[model samples]
Target: MTPPLLTLEGVELGVGGRRFCENLHWSVSPGECWGVLGPNGAGKSTLLHALAGLRPVEAGTIRLQGTPIETLSRRAVARSVGILFQDQEYPFPATVLETVRAGRYPHRPFWSGESAEDQRLALTALWETGLEGFDARRVESLSGGERRRMEAATLLVQSPRVWLLDEPTNHLDLGHQIALLELLLRKSRGQQGAMILVVHDINLAARFCDRFLFLFGSGESCQGTGEEMLQEALLTRLFRHPMRAAHFGEARCWMPL
Candidate 1:
């Protein structure tokens, strides 16, 4: 069998003195899309950071392609794994195209510059993310939604085997949200890559994700398909609110009751 794209074995994560989840074992394989769902302060972002090697794991191991992630160099990790945080900023003045082109750095030599193909790919990524004519726009001047899409475009340009995204739907309008998720789904299917995203919208998670990791914010967690895990009682307990599961055609949705 092919090794998983990413794996966590006996992992523990926390902040201050509070434990988020302990003894966590999970793996993401190619062609899979996993959603991380929980209430605020549930350590969803922290978990994504830990997987991306931005934060240290309290205990246990994280492996990429069957090798310990810590053993890999930063560039190697970047080439294999990509992350999109909830908040992104461009302090320096740069065009959207320039920002997206930066993703190609991992594939180029230290002394080399962006190639024509890289530029082409960057343009394609921008177009796919609904920013076709925004290539020349200043990154700092773009609106929040535009900037979010620009970040998504940059990640598309990177094209790593594993994608770790924190609230990818942030700042997106409903139409853009659907478009972006559809684009990501298409990318995962086409490239046979894996995606793990932190999402607060249970409905959206149900629509796009095949697997879910639920953090109960009490050092307890669970993982499984939405059909197996979307029980009203479990969700109500997890979020500390009454919830009703509804089905609209073939899509399952959760609404607060």
Candidate 2:
């Protein structure tokens, strides 16, 4: 069996001193896309933050590629894991190139600018995300979907072994959503890396993810292949809705409640 690329044991997090989740344990293997499902306030985003080392772990261990996340330096972590948060706030007026260039900060110093190799990487990422021609465009002027793709491109430039995406489908149109998910799957599969996405859309999650994790009050109750785990009873209980599932071609899609 392949060792897990990332593992969380007894992990816990909180906000305003309130525990979000406790005693959480999960493992993700290379080339697997794991969708995290939970109701509002279930700490899905918090879990991603913990994996990315953006927030300190209060209780347990997060090991990335066999090393304890806590022991890794911030720069080392940045180099090993790339995160696309739900909220990507860019306060400065930066062009698309500039914004994506920031992804290289871990490798480049603040005083110096990007080198030729860095520009090549940034452009390669932008090209992959379909923003190749918009290098000079201001990030603020792009549509929500475009911005999301750009953010994805930025993370790609980091070339991490594990990609942490928080609600990546948010605000995207149907076409863009499908396109982005497909692109991510293709890229991660090629790299033999892992992608852990925090998603609320059950149908989308079912369609894209190879495996799924369902979170309840405090921690995940189940995780397995989508076909094995996305049962009607589980969906209804997880979302508190009378939901159903149907086979569409080779995939399972969640029916409207």
Candidate 3:
């Protein structure tokens, strides 16, 4: 069997002196898309940052391709892992194209300027993200949803083996949400990629993810195949609200009662 692309062993996480995740053991393999479902303030974003090596875990280890992530250099980590953060700050001036091109920064040699091929790849990402014409726009002028798509375009151009997305569809309208998820799903399948994204939409998560991780925010968590974890009981307990399992046009869906 192939080794996992990313693995968390006995990981513990917390915020504000409260431990929300305890002994979390999960592995993400190539070509897999895992959804993280949890209520607000459950350390979902915190966990994504930890996986990207941005912050230290309270306990245990996170390994990237069988190597302890802590031991890797920042550039090394950036080359192999990519994160689509929940919030982004653009403090300086740059066009959307320039911002997306920054994804190539990790792959190119020091001081090597962006090449034609890099420009092509960036344009392809922009097209894929529905920002083909918006590339010329200033990053500061785009709306929140447009900014989200811009960030996604950057992540696509980066093309890392692992994707850590926090509420990737945040601020997106219904159509854009579906389009972005499908695009990411295809990318995840075609690029030897593994994805772990935090999502609040149970139906959307059920539709797109093959694996599931539920964080209960009480120092407890669970993981399983979607089939195993999408039970009504699990969904109800996950949100502290009753949920109903229904079939909608050949899809198994869970909705709150």
Best by lDDT: 3
After superposition, the stretches of candidate 2 with alpha carbons farther than 4 Å from their true spots are 109-112, 249-251
TM-score of 1: 0.97
Question: Residues 1-257, candidate 3, lDDT per residue (tens digit)?
Answer: 78999999999999889887999999999989999998898889999999999999999999999999999999899998999999999999899999999999899988889999999999999999988898899999999999999999999988899998899999999999989989987897798889887989988888888999989988899999998999998888989999998887886777788
Better by lDDT, candidate 2 or 1: 1
Q: Order of candidates by lDDT, top first? A: 3, 1, 2
The C-alpha stretches of model 3 lying farther than 4 A from their native spots are none
Measured with C-alpha atoms, the lDDT of residue 115 in candidate 3 is 96
Per-residue lDDT of model 1, residues 65-104, tens digit only = 9888889888888888889999976678999999999999
Cα lDDT tens digits, model 2, 36-120, are 8888987788778888888888889999888899899899899878888898877768899988878888887658878988899
List lDDT for all candidates, in order: 0.89, 0.84, 0.91
- Model 2 residue 149 CA deviation (Å) reads 1.3
Which scores greater on TM-score, model 1 or model 2? 1
Model 1 stretches astray by more than 4 angstroms: none
